[model samples]
Target: MGESVLLTSTPPEHKESVIVSSAPQSRPWDVHRLPSAEGRNFLVTGGNAGIGYFTAEQLAATGALVVIGSRNPAKADAALASIRSRVPGARVRHLHLDLADLSTLKSAVDGLALDLGRLDAVVHNAGGALDDPPRRETEDGHELMFGTNHLGHYALTRWLAPLLSAAPAGRVVTVGSFAARSERLDLDDLQSTRDYRPKRTYGRSKLAQMCFGFELDRRLRAAGSTVLSAVAHPGGALDSLTPPRPPVGAPTPGERLRGLPAALMVQGKDAGAWPVVRAVLDSDVQGGQLWGPRVFGLRGQPRREPVPAHMADPAVAARLWAASAELTGTTDPHLGFR
Candidate 1:
């Protein structure tokens, strides 16, 4: 999180150069008009607030049974309350799901399978900045950023794959970030044992998440798995979902000044939810396709393409696939064996 220290003191002209130029637009006219899950089940991580909150609320308003997965069940209920307060009778239930801890992932997945009877989609959206120094690592010893942001979801997806594949036209949607350009994969130090810089580590983790989505698509096709895999990025929408995570220490004057412009351009989490919605629900969207915003990289209507650089480097992606399977220990014993 303090990787800002790695950057030179020289201030960049803009905090976020990618700016949305066009007004928000939906897809090719009802092209993604999914059945709204009327009898289907959907699992959304970090569903207590912000984009997750709004998207789940919107889906529940449409009659879907949304299983809200969050680390904090209390906060999840509050998020559900906020939605119900708005829609009068939203259908969102709460379950504890801490993405940083893989152990919790299995229990939550099992509970969902038993409680919901079926799961149509699993929205892998729980993530945030590790504001503290980069010293902390997961109990599993993976670097904190890569572990929580990427590996946790990776393992969760692996654990839930069976249910996802069983669902009719199951979709596993993973969230990506615009900052992935900073992702420089250092396979030698995948766990940050040799190096650790917060922003770089975060970007690497996001890139790994994107890579996982694409590679999973290939693997699914190879296995003839019916699940569809797609990736989406919120781009850079900072709404109530972005809790006021104050710095460990007071910020320098330059830091405050550098962040002022971004404070203005950032839209609400609701505005950021569209691209992900398109990715998860769009019928025309193909596997391995990355959906983002058309304007400013991501602030307007969702599109069917990815910004350059993010989709580059297939080699790193393949390495990431092998590393993730090795690290998580969740891969099927029958498949993925050389």
Candidate 2:
């Protein structure tokens, strides 16, 4: 239930940047044209609100059975109710999950396995831009942001890979960030134990996610698994930019000031969810492709875009894959010796 901190501080120049409307606009592939998902199932992390909630709501509105993962059951319940209120007959459920704590994943996965008869996609959308002090570690002993944003999802994906493979058109969609484009990778110290700055660490984690998403696609294809993998970024989408709904909690003053850049530079979450929904539902999109907004590197319709230079390195990706496996204890044996 903890919110992600803003990835960047507001620049003085952003004060003069133009403010735009938050309404959803026409796009090539948009929520309005989303295909029916009546028989399909999906799981979205951090789905209680923001982009994740909208993603789940859009899918469930079109008849997909959605399972939202959140650490707070009350918030999840509120989200589910909100969905049903907006889209009558939406088939939605919530499961408690804390991405910063790995010990809780087993029970979550077990519960999901029982609930899901078939899964069409899993969206790794749970992550924060919160800037905790340097070297803060999760219950699992990894740096908090990296562990929650990348490692926990890594473990969750590995655990759920089989069920996804069984579905006729399974996909794994991991959310990246525009920060990946401007940031450099520190493969040697991915945990950021050596030195930790919030934005840099967040960018590194997103870069790692981009690498993992593409590499997993290659591995799945090489192993002949039916599931597909794709990555997407939300550009500058922020909760503040989205049209206000029922209030959950008030934003801190820092959060308010930080969101000013977004008010000028970013699109709202409704449009931001496009690329993610596209990655999950677009039959034409290929595995390993990246999607994001079309303009200002901040907002617009979804389009295929290049992966970050660091993320595109095959050797780096392989190393990251092995390291993730070691970190999550998901070796080939754990993956059915694939």
Candidate 3:
């Protein structure tokens, strides 16, 4: 959805204003060049489909033990089979997780405890906006989009922070969005009880996620912890890029029409997952920095993007963090300043 603007060349005056600078010499990260992830463990939320599935598959192919947190057993089994076929002997398992239901999400860690030796990375990518569904609240009573996208991941990361800290280089890579660039954080009405719109609410949720991700990194650094937190966005990638569904019913004639906008301006899921993968494994990437498609925020390569002015505000971040903790009833003692 953020592909409306395209930057072909950089002018001297606009250099600082641009979120992504075109690096003349540096090449974008190619998945083929990835180092082995052997002995590392990664948990990917929403691993059943779309960008999350591709990210998990890429990790599994690189010899990482991937724990995919998904809500549906059927979709999880299908994704597992796809991974196995593509990456022979791929070590991967699935855990049931419903982002709308906090209790179900909490079970993800406990369910995988026996198999999880050390948490190397956690990829929070499980969130979607319903298409014109009735106004809904999560099981936790928060707005559906905000609760599922922000609060759920907030709790999950806090619960697993200790495990992440124990690893040599742990990371929490949250999948944010390019849509967020158009929205502002509305901390006063987080649940949207006063005024609500689906697309805008989705964008607000993404903004909250970005703020939390950067703020978490700041707190971790202050606490002298090695665990790093960063945010990544899949610019303009759409569901139409995924593999076609098996013909079970009448063919939907206008399906491609709905995706035409994204098709023209976006890359496939394979390329969309690059930023998240880079954030998870790239040693050069540090905490608090954001990664996104370098080519006009639509498609090309992952680049360290500049944080938005609002998101960079420490006061806003602190307020959001405090509110999130209060909403989710989660607190990380390790993050406390000594």
Superposition error at 295 for model 2 (Å):
1.2
lDDT of 2 by residue, 168-251 (tens): 978899999888888777878989988889989998898888888888888888887778889998898876666444543335
1 or 2: which has the higher lDDT?
2
TM-scores, all candidates, are 0.80, 0.85, 0.85
Off by over 4 Å in 3: 1-28, 243-264, 333-338
Model 3 worst lDDT run, 10 consecutive residues: 16-25
lDDT of each: 0.67, 0.77, 0.78
For model 1, residues 263-303, the per-residue Cα lDDT tens digits are 55554465576777667665676788888766766566677
For model 3 the local lDDT of residue 180 reads 89
Query: What is the lDDT for 1 in model 1?
Result: 13
Off by over 4 Å in 1: 1-35, 240-266, 307-312, 333-338
Ranking of all candidate structures by their TM-score, best first: 2, 3, 1
